[model samples]
Target: MIPLRALLYRRGTPVMTLLIITVNVLCFLFEMAQPFYLRESFIARYALIPDQPHALTFISSMFLHGSLLHILGNMWFLWVFGSHIEDAMGPAKFLLFYLISGIASAFVQFIVYFGSPIPTIGASGAIAGVMGAFLVLYPRVRVVTLIFVVIFVTTVDIPAAFMLIYWFAIQLLSGLGSLASISNAQGIAWFAHVGGFLAGILLIRLFREKRARYQYR
Candidate 1:
């Protein structure tokens, strides 16, 4: 099932969430504004490549996306979940958590791929970390999702635990398949998603403020 949104109430401003989205959009626009070859060169230079990983790319690459749909999906997930996370964790730490998660995600993907030359870009990895934090912070929350399979299509509300677990499983299986194929260029960096998620699960505590951990209402 494809998650639509979490069925929960959120108050206060999600300023950081909007800011991040704006920054991503601006970055994409900047990339697009350049000449074709310059754009290509820019992306290649900033994107995280496993064979020759650059320290800065670990963070820069998260803001880069290969296509429109890529950024849309990542931003959608971020909008759907990031607000509450930012509200719960507080905006400052939430931002820090996000950057750290992105770096960790790239690092993990680099380790898994080891020597692949394909450049990994996009915000999904960091978004996955937000998802991991969501799952841990609000596992009981329900998410309205679209269930689509072949000719079947429906919408339903599923518990966050189930949805996240399913999502993680898909990433793990796809990552394993990618490994077996020894190809990280099939489009999706599954392990990046996995690593970011795992980082969220483990690192969220350090980022979470002293406020009540469970703020669902």
Candidate 2:
């Protein structure tokens, strides 16, 4: 199912969400400009490799993409779900939360595939984190999803919580399946999505606690 947008409305503007989309688009354009061999080399160097603990790659890899579809898919989800989360947390906190979730997601994936030589890249993990936060903060919000079965295309309204939980379950199941396979060649970082979603949930709880204390002051 492809999520088009959410029905939730925020009181303020979503500047951070727009900025993130712009950055991802610009990064994808840069990737497209490079020659084939150079682009591959760029992805290998910047994308997170399990064995390489290069500090900068963790941040850089999140902005890089393997293909047009990969970046577009991630950006689509971010644009749909990230705005409400950013509005709730404010731009500064939202940006920090996003980067932290991405970093945490990469860390967990690296731990899982410590000996493997595959390269992990893209912003899906971080976008999954945004979905997690939205699930908690706006459970009643409705999402417009495109469902294509056979030749029929239908648009359905689903609760944010249900949509996110289903997405999380798919990632978890895929990750588990990858673990069982002798060769981890799924070409997707399911574990990163799992980790990022969990990080976002935990961070939201922490933020709520702080907000509560501030309100009581």
Candidate 3:
């Protein structure tokens, strides 16, 4: 199911979400401009390779993308769920939380595939965290999702919490299956999604309290 938008609205402008989307798009454009060799060089330097000793790559790799679809998919989720999350946490805190989630995601993925030599890159993990925050902040919010089964395309209104929980479950199942099979897929860091999602759930209390305080003022 592809989420088109959420029914719930925030009280304030979502400046942080717009800025993040712009940055991700700009980064994708930069990646597109580089030559094949240069692109590989950039990914090698920035993307989080499990064996790499440098810690900065964990943060840098989140902004990197392997393909247009990869970046677009990540940005789509960020745009769909990030606005409400930013509204809840406010700009500064939202940005900090995003980076922290991405870092945590990278750490978990590294641990999951410590023996593997694949490079993990993309903002999906951070965006998944944002979705998790949204699930906690607006569990009853309605998500407009498009489900395409065979030739029939139907749009359904689903609760944000249900959609997010289902998504997390899929990621967890896929990650476990991959590990069991010892498969080396080029993309899709399921463990990163799992990690970021768990972190977001753990951090929901801080966000909720802050929002409540702001609402009282």
- Candidate achieving the largest lDDT: 1
Better of 1 and 2 by TM-score: 1
For residues 1-217, write the lDDT of model 2, one tens digit per residue.
Answer: 9999877656567898899889988998998899988988888889898877788988888998878889889988998888777767778888988998899999888888886778899998888788888777777778899999999999999887888899999999989888977265549999999999999888876443243211100
Ranking by TM-score: 1, 3, 2
Candidate 1 lDDT, 12-114, residue by residue in tens: 8799999999999999889888898788889989999889888899999999988888888899999988887887778999899999899989998899888
Estimate the TM-score for candidate 2: 0.92
Most accurate candidate by TM-score: 1
* Candidate 2 collision pairs: none
Lowest-scoring 10 consecutive residues by lDDT in candidate 2?
A: 208-217
RMSD, every candidate, angstroms: 1.6, 3.8, 2.7
Off by over 4 Å in 1: 184-186, 213-217
Spell out the clash pairs found in candidate 3: none
| TM-score of each predicted structure versus truth | 0.94, 0.92, 0.93
